[model samples]
Target: MLASRNRDTNSLLKSEKKSLLRFLALYTSLVILLITLLSIFYYQSQEKLMFSNQRAELSKYAYIQTKRLKVLHYFFPERTTYPRDPRFKSAIYDIEYKKIFSLLENENIHFNEEIYRAGNYIHFVKLLDTYYLGTKYLIIEVPEDMAWKKEAWKQIAIGSVLAFILFMVFGLILARLFLKPMRDSIVLLDRFIKDTTHELNTPLSAILTNIEMMDTDVMAEKNKKKLNRINIAAKTVSQLYKDLTYLTLKQEQKDHKEEIELQGLIRDRIEYFTALANTKQLYFELDTENVIIHADKQKITRVIDNLLSNAIKYNKRGGTISIKLRIGSLEVSDTGVGIDEEKIPFIFDRYMRFNQSEGGFGVGLSIVKKILDEYHIKIEVYSTINKGTKMVLTW
Candidate 1:
């Protein structure tokens, strides 16, 4: 029964995993989008502020140049033709030559001109100061007239990359953190299933054995028949209990890949269940090959027992239970009430009952499946209702 639950749990987990991953991907994408938008906004704001400051400084310089021209045009009349102070010593279109001569002439005035030149610089002007007492013309340079906005672009690139990296780091860590509790819950559930199955084995065995020891013959004939059917019911529970234990602990038994005679194994298990078959008046049909299987003996025994007992329980009165152990296959064919086509695959699932009168927990074939899986074996079942059923196990 837990085996079926495990399969169902696995399916649920698989579905949940897909949803979690899709959600994580979507959240990560959203983080990236928000970060990109913020980076763009930050860079735009900084660009606007930087350009605004540049424009303010340029406007102040233009106003100073216009005022200086007005002063020079009014106060200096002999210099209306542009006075040549000894301070203005270079030829008319040479600011470099003028500054060089002025520096050699007077260190104090040259220092003041150099300070102003460093701030609102006009490179190709003719005078010591573009704001000098001039002949009524002014020269102005704006930082915006440059060919490239290199610094603004550099800041934008750096900010965008940093935002992208920051979001990636946070997204990965958050996704893992969010999924941790779910992973732990799944692990706890698996352990609980395994533990519960283990606890059931001892009591179920005692119940089956005590029922077998009951004195049914001394009772009314009808009561005797009812007791016998109860015994069958008990055995079916015992079968399911055994299968659950097998699926849980059978793996660590170190009982894989053994060379054993197939005929002897079949005979041994048949003899063990001979009493049960006798109660149901089912005849045994055995076909042997002296073959050897490299597999666990106990697990194979469980598979045989489940199949044989099922055939006996579901068979008609005095039905034939045929078992064949061939070279590459082991087949069990029963002259019992067969199965519907739709129920064949479902039989391997837990607690799936097609016939309520079968008196089983419906875990036998699931155990058969588990054992066969360990040995890399495959099984096929074909049946028609009330006719017969044949099961083939291929290795």
Candidate 2:
């Protein structure tokens, strides 16, 4: 039971982790997308502000060059020095947008915009009131300033990283809060099942013990049949009780593996379920070898018992159950209502009921699967609807 509890707890923990991961993945992806957009917006706004702030300085340089050009234009070709400044490079274009003379590094200029960036320079176009020396357009060029961009990117990266960390912490808290109700419900149910299974042990043992001790001899034939019916019913409940107990509390019980003869174990389980099988007129066809394997006996018994129980429970009247055991494998085949191909995949899922016609909690195969997995055994299912089903376990 200790082991079973651990497996259950681990399974639940795995489920919780998966849910949290899915939530975080989606949440973080959206957060990243939003941050990217905001970063782009923030950078663009900063670029516009930088352009605005630098405009006055550039305009002052343009004024100085224009004044110089006017003075040189007044003196004709003799006094032509064409204004030059150490603070900025200048370009002149005629009314046709053709360059007259240029000191700017990049000759390609956008005349339509008053200010724009081209290559590694910022060009500011200024219209002169006087076309001094036939210069209608005055353009100023300066080396591109990317200091603001660098700082903006740095801040954006830091802010984005910090935002992600904070959101992740909040997301974790939300995930746990979302799962609290579900976890509490499961805990309540688990406690109830554990308590119920514990309460059932004493009564189930007494009933089985008294039935086994009963002597049907010298009784009326009708009375003997009634007693037999009682015994079968009691045993059915006993098996269910055992299954519940196995799932609920076996934690303290240490797993003890011993050399077990497969043939004898198979026979024993068959005999144990013989009364239940007889009720449906189902018979077993045993083709077992004297194969010996070392495994936990109780766990192995549960596996065999579940396979046989399912075969008998789902079989048609007088149906044949074939049990074949080999050196490293066991196969249980039944001429019963076979499972649907799609349903077969989920047959071992806990509390999964495919056929509502059958009366069961649907944990039998689930228990069988857990035990098989613990021993690293592989189970395969072959089924055809309305034909039959076969379960093979290969270690």
Candidate 3:
């Protein structure tokens, strides 16, 4: 039984570790995906805003040049002439802003029109014109430059660097803060369970011994009855000890199975609880085969001990405790207060007691669960309220 339990425990731990890793992986992947999407959206919007500002600046320049060209055209009316003020860009005209004979004759040119290209100005189409006809020609083009995008990129780099530094600093602090309380809680609970189990060992031994020392035939029936009460007390403590030890042992060592004789292990635990059973006049129906299973000895002992103890503890006086062991399986059944459907789900949880009046820390089933899980053994509990509980293990 102990060997089987250890095997169950180890296998369970491996699966739990695997599940935890997968969860972390999924969570981190989601965070990265969200950050990536937001970064892309932010950069695109920044690019658009930068481009808008550049276009506004170009439009202002175009307006100022338009006014300058109008003045130049009026002065150089009838013929093509070079500008007196060459600081600004201007299109000479013939007599008017339209009609023929500027630097280029009889040709009109369009300015401030989109030529979507790289240079600051597109071609000033006509370079020569004869007198009169007032021709308007010449156009300037300002192409989009990489400078606007470069500025946006710089801002993104600086912002992202700052955000990264802050996230690292706070993320570490947040993780430590969140995990500290949970770690402390587990450690304190483990220590308490271990210490309490140690305290119970001596008293429980004395009770069991004293009960054995009683001579039921010689004493009054009432005295025998009192002895039965003492036996119950002792058995309860023994169950508690087994459960606490089982829990602590898991923390202390890695689970490993050694070859064990299942039939012998089951019989020994039964005998250990035999005196308590006699006190209740409960019959033991142990049907076990000489099966050898590889598992941790201690954990297997705990599994059998917990189940037997629970059976005796909860059973009515003169009721029967049934224990069955086969290759790859074990079951303990009793005529006791069966669990309610709602409570069944939580029966195996640590510190969960269906009956607080029963003297125990409510960790027996939890320890059983832990051990079975390590061995890759599955447990299912069936019960009818106020009737009985049957806990089955399948490997």
Candidate 4:
């Protein structure tokens, strides 16, 4: 049951994380897009203002030149004199929009009132109201002011980078705010499980101890059978209670490590499960060497108990369970209903049960895996449906 709870919590955490990431990604994208659009608008507005200022200056220059031409045209018609402005190049066009005279020869200039950029110059065209020497359009071309444009671009780049950094920080803050409730709920659930497991430990231990103390020799045959069933049921609950206690409170327990004889430990655990095995007429074949391991005795016992319990619980009637313990490895193989190929990968995952028909909380392998991992032991499992399963542990 604790394993099932853990699995549910893990699944919920994964779902919450995925949702948070998706929301953050979308929020960040929209924020970045808005910043980009604003940057573009600001840049274009600055460029337009610069261009407007350039056009105003060019208009004033053109007006001065036009005034000079008008004076020369009305007073001194045969002089062929033109206004000279050394700041920019000037051109004159007739009413037909054909260039009549220019400071620069063979230059292609568009005759329009709007300011335009061509090559390395800002071109401005204006139509004069009063004709001077048959001139109708006064066109002026000035060298572009690149320094101001470079500064504007630099500002835009800096602004964009700063905006991106600010939005990222805001997005992270928003994500944490959104996930706070889920985090609180998970914390509450963990606290509840810890408290509940703490409450169950005493009663479960009392029940198992009382059952173990009961004498079967003085009871009737019928009563003996009933006692055996009760014993079996109590042991099953005890195992589950142990798994939960280990998961919730094992860290609080004192560590006591010692050299344990593998053969002797296996024999003891198998003896404890013999009565349960006999209910299904299951037999055990032990082929073990006298190997000793240095580890916590209780933890190693839990590992062996879970493996032996699972083998008996899932074994077929009159089936055989083979146990092998060598120098660096221990293997438990059984001729019980085996797991499917697809379920093999997740066999050790919390709450994962292949044989639903069997009576168990499905936490046995999960506990086994945890204990093995703590001891730096590697476990390998091979199973085929309706055939058998072999669990091998290598230290």
Q: Pick the candidate with the highest lDDT.
A: 2
Per-candidate count of clashing residue pairs (backbone under 3 Å): 0, 5, 34, 0
Worst 10 residues of 1 by lDDT: 99-108
**Which candidate number would show the highest TM-score if scored against the true structure?**
2
Pairs that collide, model 1: none
- Candidate 1's residue-wise lDDT over 1-395, tens digit each? 68556654653465357657787789877877786787678767865665566556545554554464556657766455432333122112233333211211222232223122223322112233453542222233432333224665676678778877787777767766887676666556546656767777787778778876887767899988777677766665666667656655664467666787889988987886776787778899888789887777778788888888778778888889888888999999888888889888778765456478866556677677867887789999889898888989998
- 1 or 4, which is superior by TM-score? 4
Q: How close is candidate 1 to the true structure, as a TM-score?
A: 0.46
**RMSD score of candidate 3 (Å):** 10.3
Per-residue lDDT for 247 in model 4? 60
lDDT of 3: 0.67
Q: RMSD of each candidate?
A: 14.4, 4.7, 10.3, 7.9
lDDT of 3 by residue, 52-127 (tens): 6655664555455555555665765563454332322434444344533232222335544332333443233332
Return the lDDT, model 1, position 305.
Answer: 88
lDDT, candidate 4, equals 0.82
**TM-score of model 3 vs. true structure:** 0.56
Model 4: weakest 10-residue lDDT segment is: 6-15
Q: Where does candidate 2 clash, by residue pair?
A: 1-249, 1-250, 1-251, 2-250, 2-251
Better of 2 and 3 by lDDT: 2
